[model samples]
Target chain A: MYEGVVQDLIDELGRLPGIGPKSAQRIAFHLLAADSTDVRRLAAVLVEVKDKVRFCRTCGNVAEGEQCRICSDTRRDLSKICVVEEPKDVVAIEKTREFRGRYHVLGGAISPIEGIGPDDLRVRELMTRLADGEVTELILATDPNLEGEATATYLARLVKPMGLRVTRLASGLPVGGDLEYADEVTLGRAFEGRRLLDV
Target chain B: MSLYRDEGVVLRTQKLGEADRIITLLTRANGRVRAVAKGVRRTKSKFGARLEPFTHADLQIYAGRSLDVVQQVETIASHGDAIAGDYGRYTAGTAMLETAERLTAEEKEPAVQQFLLLVGGLRTLAEGSHPPGLVLDSFLLRSLAVGGYAASFDDCARCGRVGPHPFFSVPAGGVVCASCRSAGAVTPAPETLGLLAALLTGDWAVADASDARHRREASGLTSAYLQWHLERGLRSLRLVERT
Candidate 1:
């Protein structure tokens, strides 16, 4: 523990995810040594973000208003909704510029060890969105990991009776990754999902 | 500081910084150890994908003051991919990992039996040889046994009386005879007790031939017993979709 406010600052910073005690202390000292204007700017942005941003009512994506930009965009296909685990994943998919459709952010995956279950996520909201039968295709863009796959499987089973064409993202080796260095499971998946090359 | 090599299972991981991760591993010889794997969050990380949960890896670690650093890691079994593809297996595997972590509460203590049980459970789960739920239950029972909390299915837990016990009591260690039966003791079907015994003893043929209803009953009893012994319920066990 340090003197008064310095310890308080470290404790506060440490509460943030991924910021451990050592890093929190280091950051607090760095902030104290740096210009007050920079620290104030960062503080202001943090408050501003919490005050202005909210989850989109329809899709659960982070938004400034009732709906996110993707949810509000009429040009995007409403008949398709690419479901992702987080808003950050939405940005990653959007950067590809390939998916011209709406999105449903599940907030987080079903991590039982973390005590996050189907009920904790935005699953009910997603089910409500699909109840209208407007979405013709539901693309599961969840990360290809344990929790992500669990969430996808749960959602897939839930929406199977709804007659929606559900699909999942193809997972394989990275573009520049070497085949010899690839793990057997990933290599096997790459082979299983091999595509025909077009010249 | 010295460097050492060990084969271990990746029990869990937490993000340490922008591009680093702190991994908790249950090693075959070293027991539970937490190590910082620098740059594992980066896209180009050499062994990042191999260090995921349920993965068995051969790791070279650099001993540090507060935490050991993972210098090199090579994949031994990538069970994560197989487990993740199926919901039943995924939940079961998650529960197994959690149990392994919980059983080996002390760090750097050799827990070869617990380690072997986890590896075997993960392998069986990945192979789809048995119902994922059964494998998970078996793992839990065996891990508890190795952790010195073995529950008795046959005979009495408290009085050690002979003959098949009729009542199961969580607080009394396991199945209790009428003479030793305490409050809140449950009378599971004879088949549920048989199923639990089969799972604990690795009698897969009997376990596989068991009915679904018995399996469900056995699962409930097993979970209750586990919670009672551990003094807390496993979060992952609640999410397991029994097959």
Candidate 2:
């Protein structure tokens, strides 16, 4: 252990997800050698983010006020709602420029190994958004892994009686990839979801 | 670096560093092994989906200081897609994976029986031939037996008495005789015991012909017995759809 406040900093940094003890120690040393002004700016930004950023009321995406930028936008298509697992997912989908609808961040997926279930996510909020009959399509963009698929299945069953067009993102080979390199599961899904050629 | 080859099932994975993942596998020869797969989370990863839960794969691993590094992977059976397509089967498969990891308490220890049981269980689950609940129960019973915590459906678990006993106790190992019956013992139906026996011995005809009520009762007893021996209940077991 290091002396006094330096040790305290390392402990706090170590508590963050994916930041282990070794990385925490390295980051602490790097901060110590940096300029005081840069450190102060980082500290100020951290405090300001905590004070200002809050989850959107409609969706669970991170926001500065009542709603996120996407939720507040008037030009976005109101008939579609794409559900995702995290705020980072919203950024990823946004970069594609293919989807112009709003999003619902579920906060996380249903991972039984981690003791997480549907109740732990923002399912109830998404249902409320759909209750108004504004959304004609509900797109599930959750990850293709086990926990994510379970969450999507749960949501699909829950909303089946509501008469909405529920759809999940297709699983297949990645773009700009060779077919021989794809895994069996991916290859199988690609064949299952194959499209017919239109002359 | 010394390298070795093995065939195994991917039990689970956790993120490491920026793009790598620490994959835990239950192998036919090496038992439970944890290895790092570099850049596996990236989109262009060659075998990312093949390392998912319930997937059977042939792997080449390089021995590391603390954790081994995965060098090559070939899919032997991609049961994940078939199992994950349905909610009931997915939850059952997850519980099986969790139990496999839980039963093998040591790393690098050979557990060939446990590995074979898991592979067969996953295959049965993916095939959707029987109810997922039944498949999970059978897997749990067999896995417990391999782990040296086998439950007795006939004869006395506590005493040397014979004949079918009435009282069943989880802590006492299984069905107890009248002379050995103690507090907290439950008197399950005769059919529940028969169903459990059929499950353990792979008597699929008897198991498939059993009634739904008996299946539910057998599942409760099986999970209780499994948790009792494990000393802690499996978190994923509760999420499995028993019906």
Which has the greatest DockQ?
2
TM-score of each: 0.92, 0.96
Clashing pairs in 1: none
- Candidate 1's C-alpha runs over 4 A off are A1-44, A177-180
Q: Report per-candidate TM-score of chain A alone.
A: 0.92, 0.95
lDDT string, candidate 1, A98-152, tens digits: 9999999988899888877888999999999999988999999997756777788
Q: Write the per-residue lDDT of candidate 2 for residues B119-182, one digit (tens) a residue.
A: 9999999999999999999999999999999889998999858858888999888899988998
**Model 2: per-residue lDDT, tens digit, A1-199?**
9999999999999999889999999999999999999999999999999999999999999999999999999999999999999999999999999999999999999877767777789999999999999999999999887778878988998999999999999988888989988877778889989999999
Please report the candidate that would top TM-score against the real structure: 2
Error of 2 at B9 (Å): 0.4
Q: Residue B112 CA error for candidate 2 (Å)? A: 0.3
Off by over 4 Å in 2: A17-26, A197-199
Per-prediction interface RMSD in Å: 2.2, 1.5
Q: For each candidate, what is the lDDT?
A: 0.89, 0.92
